[model samples]
Target: MQNGSSLSIAERGCFHTDKFDDDGKIKRTGTWKSATAHIITAVIGSGVLSLSWCFAQLGWIAGTVTLVLFSIITMFNTILLTDCYRSPDPVTGTRNYTYMDAVKSNLGTFQYKLCGIAQYGVLTGITIGYTTTTAISMAAIKKSNCFHKHGHNADCHAHNNSFMLIFAIIQIILSQLPNFHKLSLLSAVAAIMSFTYSFIGIGLSTAKIIGEGIGNTSLTGIPIGKDFTGMEKMWKTFSALGDIAFAYSFCFILIEIQDTLKSSPPENKQMKIATATGIMASTVFYMLCGVLGYAAFGNDAPGNFLTGFGFYDPFWLIDIANICIVVHLLGAYQVLSQPFFGFVETWSKEKWPQNKLVTREFSMWGFDVNMLRFVSRTTYVIVTTIIAMIFPFFNEFVGLLGAGTFWPLSVYFPIEMYISQAKIRKYSFTWIWMQILSVACLMVSLVAAVGSTHGLITSLQKFKPFQSVS
Candidate 1:
């Protein structure tokens, strides 16, 4: 038998590796550089495109502080979790355990199941949000007057918008093809695209800052919007932006960490280094994007944040931004699909067999539901499609959903995993600190989701206007 091919779980619940090759000799080593790249790609996603909107909501100083704090907390929890995951069980000795497994081994099965469901929900939510973001950006680009359409040619833009949606779906399907190695490659490509946008944004922002100069003197003569008058109003705006920052940082860091760290060789340091670098790099990009965006667009930047720079042509900027977003979503789709595919693989192997005969025989009324053997695949397609369709109707609500669900995965879950696995195991000051920080992160997400959702609903109610830009 080929080496490692016969490796399996043993009677002791330990995993045994087949050491001998066909000639009874050990195989050589594999390089982990590509594996490191995967970690970085998984962390940076579509959320980066929305950082300026989040900054606008929170304002410059407050948003910066919140982002910094989130990063520090994330770093601490990740290091701790990576260290604590040194359990002696050989079955768990591999580096690439799922977040659900980490939860199970450290926090108990109940919490594991709960985290599993949440993670699934969050993954689906993210996919939907990306779809909506794509659709909205497409619509904006089409509606812009620069795309001159004499007479009924205007309807051509609408057709093109729908085509973009179909294009996005196709991209997703292509990414889901059988080549697993492609994910890491796609991730590296995404990093390149993201840096392109970040640098462009920084250059534009620096130009704006130099033109404006420092102090309230430059601020005074400018004609500000009537609604943006008071210091109280500004504070409220800043606070809302802070919530957005909380959501962005939370989601980006969490999904990246869980995917990369869990997939890394359990005792290896290389993957951890790669994962850390990815998250930190993303954080730096975010800060640069925020500063640059605010400089060019000011506070009243439009809904599709990155494309809303007043200094540039909205149409061109949006098209470029939309392209970057599509690439980023590709990475997100891969990482999210990893845990999801793993879940299906595990469940089908362990649970599907026992239920197969029963499920086939038990008809729903007179209808034979064995047709539902396709349930898992059908569920994924339908749920993803429906959520993607409905979410665009309330963009802000979906944004918050992305934030709230992602925060737990990012800020709270890793720390909890660490605390649960600490050799001391029993309660201690460090555990207490972790819990406090975890709850705080959770609360911030809760507030962001609730606030954004409320804002969305109220806006939807006041006007049902289509053809008007939000």
Candidate 2:
């Protein structure tokens, strides 16, 4: 197969030519509103639920700073990526559709492969995280109701893996949807779910604080200069940074989301606007959830805010939030997994161009089905589900993947691509600043990755296979 660099200028010119309609305009399907919805859906996932614990680790001051900085950096990276999306080649009117395509066009074949590895790895990790989170949410609901009725009997523990499997089975059915653009409505629903749960969480936290004074709460983390070593504080701070960064790390799908937007003159500009609006809205929700949750629980905040609440008095509302989470993750799994499905399908097509493998059709209950998509997407969901069932450390695993890949995919690649596309000179102000940003993020990511991985490994050694996470 011809790699990006191996493709001659003539071959490059033909790229994405078919995307245009007869009028020579790119075929547009989604609006800026839908694009914003997709961005919000992609950005706010299980990560938001963990922000209170993150703030506990970092303290209010450090946590707020980290969240704001990461938000800004993420927005900058998104803008840089969208700029690369439709910047036409001098000869070819071809536009890049995927993250890997953009990397290939600007960087080369080798960098493209590297980016692909990181991109898919991150995407797969996210799918697993969602699966694990869905199961956890379901289990939380089951256990909370069980405890409320049975008064903490160990026998009442619902089989957590069973819930994971159930959700995984549900995802198998949902994954059959044909393409990402077709998921626009689901994305909008996911966005609404995100907002709904976040509002509920914030409200509950506020109610808790009002019912029981803040002074009565036991909070975690050391205030600056309060009986803690600098290294200990640094470790906690960086770990929290990883969680916040993970919350904002949605760069992988930026191009795909942008491609769904209606093609217009201010194309890149529109995307930036949508992106900014989404990020800002998400940031507000995050701050409210994190700050209020921490204030309510103090040092006792659980990694998952909902789980921490247990079966409180207003149990019905908690159940509603948990249900929303499960529903949202059902869609979230597809949002992340669709790209992986596309990757495999694209690979299959290239490897066997004339074999009619992916295109092979069959009848199932009078519905036409593509066997290749059915098998590939089903296998992907199953694998992730199995992994989630095995490990089941939702927050820890999220931090691990976020810390490991955030720098390379979210920070380094965008900066590197921007520099290459703009031909910024070495040591130039723009180049140096971008490099510094990448390096700084890389350093933090590495620290958080190592810490989270070590913590996970230790947990695994003590963890029994298929054990319930609660």
The model with the greatest TM-score is 2
TM-score of 2: 0.90
Model 2 residue 202 distance off true place after TM-score fit, in angstroms: 0.4
Tell me the tens digit of each residue's lDDT in model 2 across 1-470: 22322344334465354464322334566777888998888889989989988888877777777888888998899888878885543113456778888889888999999998998999998888888788878877877677677676545556788888899889889888877878998998998998898888988889888988562222345554556667656665566667787899889988777777666644577788889999999999999998888888886677887866654446678888999898888777788777778888878877876665565666789766777888898988889888887788866787887797679888888888888877889999888888888999988898888767765776788888788656
Error of 1 at 251 (Å): 7.4
lDDT of each: 0.53, 0.79
Write one digit per residue (lDDT tens) for candidate 1, span 241-304: 4344433433322322433332324433544565477668878887777656655566654444
Candidate 2: segments with Cα more than 4 A from true spot? 1-26, 88-93, 152-155, 215-235, 361-368
Model 1 gets an lDDT of 0.53
